[model samples]
Target: MTSTTTTPGGPALELDDIQAGALMPRPNPYAGAFWGLRIDDRHAGRELLRRLIPLLKPASSFDPERPVSLGLSLTFTGLRALGVPQESLATFPAEFQQGMAARAAELGDAGENAPEHWDKPLGSADLHVVVAVLARDTVLMESLITLAGDALRDIPGVVPVWYLDVHVPADGREQFGFKDSISEPAIEGTGILGSNPHEASLKAGEFILGYEDETGAVAPLPQPDVLGRNGTYVAFRKLHQRVAAFRQYLQQSAADRAEQEWLAAKMVGRWPSGAPLAVAPDKDDPELATDPTRNNAFLYGDDPQGLKCPLGSHARRMNARDSRINGDVRLHRMIRRGTNYGPSLPSGVTEDDGADRGLMFAFVGAHLGRQFEFVQREWVNDGSFIGTDEKDPLVGANEEGRFTIPNRPIRRRLKALPSFVVNRGGEYCFAPGLQALRWLAELDT
Candidate 1:
């Protein structure tokens, strides 16, 4: 159905046409904020979008050494509020139209993830827009927010309903003490693809809309050409991590510090230093982890029996490289950009810290139903494809699940896996291309 050969050439990425947040991560932003707003007046909302256009950051703004980033995404309701026609709105994927709460059961978001427990803005009908800002520190982030507010001062209809902030430590370690953002999919068009030749590059349409997907057909586009040409759907989620419980579990499971680290790596498929277990199975290799060219260069084919990397591990299941699956892996690939939020618990403190902390997960793709939702419902939360019923150890919602780690002496099974990650809230948003923003700004009520 899809091209099996790994094509070295891909469509040239139109960086300026795409929103920066959809393709690349902010350059080491220390602080960030997500502003969720509701549109009270369609005309005012359109004018506000016009005013905000100048502030929208394009994908071209990403500089690995830079210190500033800001971007915006809108819910389907937000677009409708801005005067986008009903015909165009109907063209969006059903998942986006229904919102995240409507399909909680399919996403395994029952119990704590029920709509009643979600943030008010995410579940309420009033939510329209989500503006995300990231910067090197709090002061810079505040300044940007202030500038945005000043731009929207004349627009009275847009009201802020919720604000969530993100905190990334200097060391770049998550609350669970592992290096995050270590692995990401390489898109064909984006020149940002690294020299990790082992991993195959995915089709451009897998991430960006209006491009040919893996099946060699241009992915579906929303009506009114400018509105959906280069835009992509985004699944924004706030995941809270129980750091104390996770650390305590590791401590009680393993006999010593080294074994504890090993158990943790087996669960995550990566060492604290960001070194993947598939490459450095025995110990943490900070050098390899730090090396961009070598860190993501391993595959699962060589160790089919889970010797190098367990098939059910979090990373392995999330992106199963060269693993046998019912369908092509490219079809399910998504651009995952997650940033740490909340303070890190003090080392060696086993008790729960009253402070709340976790990750702000953003999944960018063209097919929300097929790409993001399928991966969440199938790969991450269920392990049936890998011949196991257990979910991902660190983030899966199943507390009764167990993780089996294959070792030379014997396979180790870690049980009583409590849910370490909780869905604080989430929304399905549309990150439009620059032209779409302009089109939205010019819309008439």
Candidate 2:
């Protein structure tokens, strides 16, 4: 595919106007996008960027096994953490100039398209530290995810919104295949292709992540004490290892069930080569595999059992399709453009043993907990959907041991669970405003 966008020199084009949500095929350098989260006077964050921007050289190289880049997002929840003088957090934009924003058109339906502000009183967003792909070196991106995770551990209140330690499949699709990222909807004005719902539609201050004053822990919103110039909130998560096992299970499933590899393809909703199940349910649809429009078309008509596709399967459960009971579930869709990490498991390996391999899931939304959290807790993990208490068998967690999706006949054979993925370590972080940067630098490390 060809593109009209060029880095030649001019005001940047709106995000959606760029092809495939990118200026080119891979990541590129964004000069003024890096930001930090910390307490500071009004506009104090700028000083820190002035210092860090020059010290940081344009990246010369990326690691083969693990690359490093910064990804950025913000949260209004951090507004609660501020001194009286700088208490008005919503007015101040983030410190980074090149970063993405949720812009709304001025004409009709502009506010309608914007996330409802029911919970967004001031529209404050507390986030920083975006590890972008300056260039497309999968390894570099991988390292960047880890680097962001590791670095944020020490930053106070910097909650991680959503992250994906992904491996751009050698086949070019995401871990679930189905032509990675074909389903992301284009939201105008934000300069982003997002799946987020309007913040105005949500409850009071319920949209922020890491710290929700109303519902803490499961949904921690920013507090009034941290309101104006609140410390950052980093979203923390660790999708565990199971790459080798999943592949092995698929192969074994094919042999044990007497079905062909195509069956396994349907189970995953994609061909190993990135094709979508919607276009080719019985065979790997190569044409649809590459065409963005053709992917993500399959929806279970009414077979609650998911006979067409396993009810509890990842794709089916993630996007409940039209089956979702209310508008609540509609907000949970994530823009998962993450890649996988770790090696392509040896085809013959029986088990990953203790191999640290799995997806690095990165997603974005105005309020992390309301959308992603709701889906993981209610839909993905609920037994009602798949017939067992499995937290997204692949990405969910159970304190007792590893999580796995039970095989067919879920109604009766409820105990057979398979561990497809695991979770590791994580924390909450915030990508701060430029004024906040100086505060971070000023703080005693």
Instruction: Using TM-score, give the best candidate's number.
Output: 1
Instruction: TM-score for candidate 2, please give it.
Output: 0.55
Which segments of model 2 are wrong by more than 4 Å? Answer: 1-48, 52-69, 72-134, 138-170, 173-179, 191-236, 256-263, 301-305, 324-327, 385-391, 398-415, 432-445
C-alpha displacement of 129 in model 1, angstroms?
0.7
Residue 239, model 1, lDDT: 91
List ranges where model 1 is wrong by over 4 Å.
1-13
Q: Per-residue lDDT of 1-445 in model 1, one digit per residue for the tens?
A: 1112222444555677888767875555378888888999988888777877887777766676755666788898888888888988999888889989887988999987777898677756777988888888889889989987887786778788888888777767788898877677767756667435777777777788777788787777987878888899989888988999988999999899999899999999999988999899889999998887888888888888888788899988888878886567778877787888777888888899688888999898999888888989998898888888889998899768799998779888989999999998888999999888888888875
How accurate locally is residue 56 in candidate 1, as Cα lDDT from 0 to 100?
73
lDDT of 2 by residue, 1-445 (tens): 2122211122222222111211112232111112335433322333323334322221122232322344332333333333323334433333211111232121111222222421122122433333333335644444444444455453444444433334454355443333444455433222223222311122112222222222322233223322222132334333455666556655654555335355555445556555655445556657766554445545555545454455565666676665544444446655444445555555556666665554455444434445545565566556564455554544444333223322356532222346555444322334432234334444431
Q: How close is every model to the real structure, measured as TM-score? A: 0.94, 0.55
